[model samples]
Target chain A: MIAEGRIVIDLSRNGDVRLTSNRGADVARLLVGRDPREALDLLPRLFSLCGHAHVAAARVAVQEDVTEAEAHADTSRVLAETAREHLLRILTGWRVEGAGFELPSPPVMGLVKNMQAAVGDPAEERQVSALLAGYLETHVFGISPAAFLKLRDLAEFTNWLDGGPTLAKAYLCQIVAHGWQGLGAVSTQFLPALSGAQLQALMAEPSFTLRPEWHGQPHETGPLARQSRHPVVAALLELHGAGLMSRLVARLVDLAKIPTQMTTGESPVRGQPGVGVVETARGRLVHAARQEHGQLKDYQILAPTEWNFHPEGVAVQALAGLHAVTGRAEGAQALIEAIDPCVAFEVRAA
Target chain B: MCLAIPAEVVAITDDKQTATVSLEGVRKDISLALLTDVEPGDFVLIHVGYALNKISPDEAARTLALMAELEEVSS
Candidate 1:
């Protein structure tokens, strides 16, 4: 809700990336004494970007009586939110790329209801799916998602992107134009799922969320990490080595399969201060809470931004060696946007 | 973790840590873990899942008096 701080990529002389961040989640500190149910209801309002995901995670973490139907709905909500998030990025990027498109709002709202329906039942799925596919084809990739997904290599991706002035293609073209292709390279090291005990234990230390670590090493936890196993993402990794292009491609890979993914994946079930690890738009979102008499004794959340933006973390590894990069601050911003922080940030070349 | 706002404690569980707080017209259950000797009428800053601080009546009245004086001076 506020401009937390700035990530200054110093290309002027040092060419170093410095994120002078002033973000603090005092909200969680306040929740220390609140009832678990109150905490659960408030989670959605707290995180505007992924309210459903947050509430779902909180509900699970508190061991609330979540029905099977509710779990499925929550899973679909994550998928829908992710899809909209990707589309919004593409939409905004296209505008920046000088594309004369006029899709003021994404049609994702229509699909939201269906997204909450029972997975695989196909509740209004056909209509919503077609609309989304058409919009992506018409406004984003300039090719069918199926066609984009079928792309086997970088060459194929380039050819498909070369077809028209859609959002992603235009941005990809800009990346190619600026020759910022291989910049912001980071290898994916995903944070494995933690049990309730493990998560609570890890979170016991202060500054754990501020500087999150996975097995004592900083790791990446976003679309790139989630879709690392996909073939196109693998191809991008092979070609670009998890650089800006690979990370961006991984996002598109996520975008491509959203229709199918939204209607299929099931959330994991756990009871007693349960830990729900949902792959939100940003990355791995962990919600952990312990309850006493159905009241929250303790609660904690580890958002993807913490993992990606740690002081000695993925951003440092990904954003190095760009001092001599020509696009300067704008280029730095593109790279940072590729990583996508959950909170507000200001990026400048120092 | 979240944006905290002041809410009035409407109800409390027997444990004294858990309570319901009303914000505007909406009432939600929240934790009172950060403050002690809280009652149904007390105001607290609600966040992620807990109350960060309790707003005392003395502080509120002092702030109100300061604002009133500032308004009179401006007038």
Candidate 2:
């Protein structure tokens, strides 16, 4: 005898689960049979940016039936999310710098030059390199420094300082010297500041508070790597703050890291119900599912951008509220950027 | 589909298949699959791996400014 069924999963902040099933065979015949090992593989293509999150959730849903290691699943989800955020930030940074309007200085120019030299296409490299160099002399230095300063203010307010005054000083020196190698070293040095406990907590839930003294002001979100390594989070109360630069940097960084983190092996567990959640470039993203008899019974995703980018309505207010009060365009822009709304990622008009 | 954002074309590729664009401080590599006759410094709304349409940054700023003005008037 053969049987078939389909299940749909929906996710929201409310955390509700609903299931319905229909069987083609008689109850008596079905009771005599064993569970089937049907292959389900349409999950990964959902969102290119959050593919890891979906995979992690699917693994947890499948493993719930057999293993007592639910916590491990959660931990793995967090780590993957952190890694994803890091890569996104890097990619975003590369693209933004590549925009040909915001070079830091000569030192930064040299770095761009080196990248073009290594790119292997002479025509493309020459065009991009010259464009970037020209942009630095005109627009990049004109707007970005002020933008960076405003970002620094937002960072301070959110208690997520970008490496405090010391690292900022070193970063400035590298910028002055065009020492790309030194800049890379300085960036690597800051990674050790993230504690294991903080990473664990971030994976488990949303909103971790720091001490009042350390809170400073409202920081930003989005860039996970910049936020994680931002000096303010460490110096103030040992808590990571959220703000625009942090959020933007986190997503940009994650874009650069994704290609390196792709693993070629099957997940450890593949046939039980589980949950996966990660702090994406936006905020907290979660995926949960239920599996029965080796098939997907239910699946759902809660996107981080949904929480931050709520449209202007009663139940869902836009982040533009605070910006409205500040009356500073840069401040408002900074705040909005921090949300890192992936409207494209959330649209399911189809 | 993919996680991509809308950005203004600060520069265009010679073939126009790709463009350098910016959104806030974050920029991206956008494909010209969804729009026609795009040029430098024009805003384009982007989605997962595709450009959906051309947006006017000036118009966007004007709208936001109007919103701010309305709030001030009400206050």
Candidate 3:
């Protein structure tokens, strides 16, 4: 049997949390020497979550330019997938009430259907977007996505949080009631967007993917960093300082913005010499590919998890700061959830 | 990066809520909540104790061969 690596958080009796990543299998190495198109086709089969983002980055990495239609198709697919991913994580991954919620239910199944439709046909983009927006409005937000997106401050957020009986409200409420809004705050910087050539150069260094740093500092990425400048997220950063509350809320804010992102079609940053970067649900996903002797050679992937979960990155820094308080495991889990590692994770006694 | 490993469904529970999947020889119970109409012998991509989706046997074989190649190279 093959080992699909996962993150293990070992918490000592003294409330010091240690993080270990077993994701040592360099799967990207397999793509080397293969036809770029074949490699792209294998991406979705290899990665069940964020597969669209993977394919999009790989497409940009192997091709120097993307036409308007391709870009729109790419943006639509990724955004649709992102909406489904965030919803699944919040609904199924969050174990807020001690025992986690059961799955295969209507909401979860609905998301899976939409997720499949996302990777299917370009003409289905509008239909998928409408279904997703309707799902969020009726089930999670208790308000229209546009209305939720316009909430700009803590008061607005708190009112919305308390104004509904939605699952999103319940999870956020638990964090607030437990005063975990500020738990696991860190001073890690946000990763800056690098040009395709710049990113290609960075990946040339063997260790860049495992412990990526922007100008020698390990910066956080993903939704929180991406949404840091949003008015509501800005207010959140000011209040919580990149803690559990801000991270969770940032995910919500990002989800609420998906429909607009689909309709508007934000141009993705291009990568020259076959390097492509895209801001995925979890964070930025970078893929670098170059041809040698008429064949694809030297392919590398830098997933957002690498940046946030680096050995000396934000997750460890935040978890290590936990004091031996009551319910330390729950706090640690919540913090990890806020950071949202893309892989499976477990928290246990050291 | 999140990489999902493909496993064969050996036996499904009576409730149809979960399935017993075997990866090579390793066996585990995975939630079937995210999928429908899965049968024994079908290959599904397993991630974090959940079966993301079902795949054709040919597709599963190709993916596993690629993974095995990577493992050999790393070793």
Model 3 segments beyond 4 Å from truth? A96-123, A267-269
lDDT of 1 by residue, A1-350 (tens): 22223344344466566655555434454345678777766565444456676777777777457777677667767777778767655554433455555553526433455555534566665456666778777776778888888887767777887886765777777887777677876665877656667777777667786788867898888788878877778877877787888888889888888766644554433434466667777887777666677566666677778888887777766666576667666766777778887655566555
On the 0 to 100 scale, the lDDT of residue A279 in model 1 is: 75
lDDT of 2 by residue, A264-314 (tens): 111222222345444454544444444466545544444444333323211
Model 3 C-alpha lDDT per residue in residues A134-199, reported as the tens digit of each score: 778887788989999888777888889889577778788887888888888787688887776688
The CA lDDT at A53 in model 1 is: 69
TM-score of 2: 0.37
Q: Which runs in model 1 stand beyond 4 Å of their true positions?
A: A1-12, A94-98, A109-122, A193-197, A266-272, B1-75
Task: Order the numbered candidates by lDDT, best leading.
Answer: 3, 1, 2
Question: For residue A132, what is the lDDT in candidate 3?
Answer: 69
Model no. 3, DockQ? 0.60
Q: Model 1 over residues B1-75: C-alpha lDDT tens digits?
A: 333345678899999969998765578888664456789888775544566456676643443343333334334
Better of 1 and 3 by TM-score: 3
Candidate 1 docking class? incorrect
Q: Model 2 fnat?
A: 0.13
How far residue B20's Cα lies from its native spot in candidate 3, in Å, is 1.0
> Which candidate has the top score in TM-score?
3
